[model samples]
Target: MMGTSGGSEEIIILSDDEDDKDTSCLIVEVEAVKKTVGVLPVSPQDEDLVVTFSRRPDVLPHARYDCPIHPFMPTDCERTAPMANNELICDQCFCYICDKLASLCGMWCCSGACHCNSHNKSDFWNDVRNTALLGELQRFNLTLSEVDHHLRNADTMLQSFRDELSALFSSIPLDQAMLPDYNINQQDLSSRYGPVLECVTLFLNKADKKNSRAAAIMHLGAAEEFMRHFQVLGFMGSSSAATTSETIIMLLHRVISSVQRRIVMGDITPLFMQKLQTFYQNRICFPADMRPLKNRFKCFIFGRNLSPVFCSLTIRPWQDVLLVSVLKGQNVSGFRKDKGKKDILFETISVVLLRTELLQLQSRYRELCRYLRVVLTDNTTLYQHLQDLIPFFKCKLGEFGSALESLFPPASPPASRFTPPIFLLYLRIFETATAPRLTVSQPEQLCFSGASWEPIKDAVPLKRSELVKFALKAQRCSLPVGSDPQCWASLLKVVCSPHGSPTALPVPSQQFLHESRDAVIDLLNQQGYNIQISRCFLKTYPDQALLLLVTGALGVRILQGSFSPALPVLHAYKDNLWAFQWLCEGMTSSEDRLKSFLKEITQESSNT
Candidate 1:
């Protein structure tokens, strides 16, 4: 109960006695119950008012709540119901208090001043509300921390490749002029050159005859494998360019020494052995070319110059010949200009001198046609003829004119790489006849869309090569996947850029930057990376833009809550992944620190 007048005043209550002398008025002096000193004098009425209604009708509104002129608790006087369980509460300020003290004091008065003018605590409402809000806050903070950490982690990952390439380039001294233009670390030298050289040494030593001879014989294959490996590692030059091999240099000398030693010993077979070794040397040394010389020494040990047995048009054992004898009597007349000069097409039998190996010939011929197709820009008819030429290379040049007319069909557009002829070739080369095509039941499944992943359902049966092609297509980048070109370009941009900053890429023209940036983004996105780029990305700095774009996109995606684990993508591009560390050398101190800082941020962010 609160009095209408302010300040510490006694309340006068009129008794309900029916005596003649008027009901004796009772004056009640409300004193502070607590004996604590220095208690400030407080007004009986509080400023803040809270009127609460009871669910039960038995509970009446206090009399102090009613007043004339200053009605409705003056719309400001503090008023509140007792606490739950019927605990005593201050009539002026709704603070909970002991029930026994409330009865003794005549009103539910708490220790706090009744007329205190201050704000009220509004935090607690319901247990459910409190729990829900707290939990949500915690979750939001955690997610933010996780996102921050992942973004940095992605930056570090991108920088790692850069670092690797840098380290590699640094290992070679400036004075080393004899080294290749693109020499990796000494380890690469050891990795590619070591095994072969070790084998060569064994071949040279007569005391180690068992190991040496075995290693020499196996050296050819090992050298080939390592050459391909180094090439994949971005160590080799172009396919057409010749690279000096340490193993080959040592092996040639070793062969010469062996020849000299055998000649001194008066060995009868020394000359023949020298010739055979020379042929093997030539085969290993030359790059693959559309020349019959490469295949001449393929089976040199079996005697390449045994005899020239001509079947029809002087087809020799030494010549790259594919003998075609049709059961039906028919003359081979439809001759390509290039084919006419290379082979003789006669009736009943056609002796085609294929300059390359069976598989190599097909590949070279197809590549030549493709190159010409792109160059001429009107080789649709020529391309169709080339498609038919695959079977023709295998000596099935039957009904050539009809086959060409049917395959070409006059004015039809040039067929895509997905044409039946190419697909059939891929099936023949890469897929086994006994193996079933991949389906939903297959072990490996490619992801095209992140939201809804389904097994690629093909109308025709799917070969492994087709699956590979589809996977590449799903990535949506013109850049070669899991290849050295991608790896080399990825690293080069960072290293070659100004002060090793991706954003500091040099642009030839300012106008091309925005267009190039979008293109770079699209390329990276196709490779399943989301990145951000400034409008300064230019076609001139594509390599730099690519590096920055991928790194930026990865960070953006990670921070924006669409992060997929990077390890899998890195693994898919393992060759490129391994190249990252060397690439990092081009980075500035800040960039290097940024990578380390990101690692620390993840930890600190999680703690927060």
Candidate 2:
């Protein structure tokens, strides 16, 4: 048993036999061990110290901080020391000589520090500096090598493209002034001209046998068909058509020459010979009723007389009737001023005359009317009745009144030679006869005094002619999908100007309007607006301001993320509200305010 005393207190342990004796020896040894290794005292402040040790510092110190080898070394110390005449220093955690950390330093590593001592005179630092800078150089060299390879490839491709383009240009025919003369056969001619020759032959045979108006009309229609064919085949000018006509005339002349030769050789029968003789005999006989037909036949034989034939076919009958009834005074009662027959005759005459001949006929008829007024002065009723006919002609000719000034003597202004009088008349008729009536409802009257009122009232009227010209210009500017950027920009500038008012803008055609609307939609979509917004813009704005509004919307969309001021949030904005507000506030607002607003929105967007 073993006993320990603390402050005069003693304790003893008893064991059985030899086992107790061994236990006492073990206890004594344990007491001796406890005295050799003492326990440290612990306090509550120690827990705080442990926590502080475990926490990370806000900022980390430099690698050189508290370094044992270079304790006085600054954090920003250079590799070379200023002292000792710029001697090289090894201050890094990694040892240059050993090529390892300082903790792993050993004498056997890198053949000890004998090489480290020779740093000042050795080429080791120079080699290391070059290696450090060479990494970036290597990367730059790789990039430049790749760029040079691509440049060479691009040069080769460009040269190949140029060679291909040159070959293509060389293969294309450049001479457009002279087209090849194709050798067309009789079948090809018939297919191209469409029975015009047959009509001409039938008319010739009928005229030789009998004096008939049907034959004359048929020949006139055939001539018209021939002219139409010439136009379709790109014989645009009168000279071109006349030149082409020579070939046809030569073909007909050959047939006549062949017939004459056959007759000389006695190739025809007796009955055919008698008919041919009678046909020739009739050519010399000039009956009064057959004179117009004879004149038309003579004109047809001579290819150069084609224009006079077109005119004479329509004018000759009327000229004969007027000469016989009015000038010769043979049938004065038939053309009596009071009779409705004269009116019907005049109407028929007007309908048959071509646009080019209308002015000439009008001047001639006006002169005749003046002559009748003087000749029938004794018969006041007949004279007054004849005077009444002048108003009908005036009313019928009113549609071409604008052109009449240039055609007649007094004022001959330079007019558009391309525009036809019939087209102009059609435009006038559409504007007058088919124009939409302005019927104001009660709700419309109340909205009349709204913000759009003053601008609509002050808007200038655009002429139909101007609208047509603008549409043609826009068509030229348009591309397959949209329009050319520069061309569209110029057109927008013109329409957005003060002189070009939106109120009176005319639609040239439904197709043109649709295409223009589609172009505007495409432009808006390209500018990042959604399809609904693009359609809304089109529905909200007038046609004249379509391009202008689109351009403005794009500007606003860039700055404010919406097409207009009224539509601040594109997704949330109502289309109905956009239409109503845009017509009022958006259109009536001054340009300066809009510009300033755009500028502010741009600044705000940039700041955010």
Candidate 3:
């Protein structure tokens, strides 16, 4: 210990302190630790019971039907019965005493023995695998297996039809070019010019069934399955807008291929769905109105059709979901190259989704409306609907947001193709809006003063640097368990101006950059947030005015103590590639000097 000018003994401690005894006295007397635990955050993950997967409960795909399946047993009803010597009060109710009974697909049995008591065998799945549609389905199965020989078989079969059409066309005499038909032609045509030129009509106009007939049939069938299965049935088009034969062929064939694969792969579960999310991040966003068929079919085989067009519409056939992609819009090509209006790929997906499947969700719009409290802006309403159905389209918000960072290069970015709908998606996933919603301080106390987070030392709202000080005061607060995590992501990304480097302010508008930056620092100081979250906020906003966020707010305080966590924050800001880098480096390095200068009136804490 050394003597101070004020006559109190001054103790000095080093990093290699040999004794823990005088260290606390020297440090605590010289400095105080300031930390702020901001709002409680919504934990990113919560433990959910691992779905002990069994066979899915039998219900329609969208219907929520839950049934617990047990191990398979013999077909003997008597042996499986829970009660011996069947003494049910009623035959329908197979209980020995109670009238209550259960039916496993209409076969009355003990609830204890019957696994699917809710179902009736008469419900038609009761029609075992080889039931009502068995024969036709067996034939349909041939479509998948005999696929290699399909076009060849079709070519031979169509030859007869081609010949039939040829003969029919030959019979129609041309009136325009002096071939008046009937009397003279009928009698002597074959003997005269008939044998030489033939009736010619069928030969010129009709397709020779031998070549294209088979392909046409298969294409038609595949197209039908895609439209019908996706619940897009009874769809009609005019002469000006026909779903082209080539397009139908592409969609149908691709689906035929995928259907078999999905079947072979067996049932999909949530666990399987989660696995798919990993790869989904990098998928190029297709345009809203994308017809992905042509894109899909270019490299594949030109195989013959499996089903006829008419039959394709009516049949319940498995087909590829990938075929349902939207056709790229011609308008997309017109985008100004440098524009970032929307992402091209997702634009296509959104448009196609809106036109196709999203229409169905409109019915569910009423349900979503109730959830939104009916006061939702049009944007919020769209957000809710998209959130629910996004999984079905293989669109996960987390994955999409994660992907957005990669797709956009640091420089020379492409036009943002996100329409309003897609933009809504971005907002929900990336950052939640805190606009117009007042966020009070932790412990959420309301004194005679307005908000707990209101001004402490300012006459007018504090200038950029000063606001950071008041926000720092909030660090002293202690909140109740499970408070909402104080938000930073949204406030940090506000971008200051409509367009500019984020650091270039819009006349320093209310200094959101400063406020948000300080808020993040406060969060870090209180041990209120994770390292990643603190980093994300700091990374997003690095203005010099916001430097205290890392240094004065967090780094300086941590440096004087034995805390190690704040050191990493130092390394992170070292690069200064973003706006706050320079300030971050300076602040962390100048820790002691800044700490003594900033907090002259230090209060000792009772709790560690």
TM-score of each: 0.17, 0.18, 0.19
Candidate 1 displacement at residue 258 in angstroms: 28
Candidate 1 local lDDT, 230-269, one digit each (tens): 4443433332112334333334434433433332222213
Best by TM-score: 3
lDDT computed for candidate 2: 0.33
Task: Give the Å error, residue 601, model 3.
Answer: 46
Which portions of model 1 show Cα errors greater than 4 Å? 1-354, 357-544, 549-608
| Better structure of 2 and 3 per TM-score | 3
* Candidate 1: Cα lDDT at 375: 22
Candidate 2's residue-wise lDDT over 1-608, tens digit each? 54557644343445444565574533223322244667788877876674335663443222222233443322121333222321222334443334454345442123322222222233664344333333322211222222233333333433343344344334423332123445434454345443444444544454333222122222222333333343434432323234435554443333333333333232333343343334333322322332354423223432344422211111222344543365344554334443555431232111222211332344444334333423322224333433333322222334233222222222221121112222232233222322111112111222222322111112233343343333232232222102222322333333443344434334334444445444554544442111222444345334533533444343333343322222232212122223223323442345665555556546656665
Worst window of 10 by summed lDDT in candidate 1: 439-448
Clashes of 1: 20
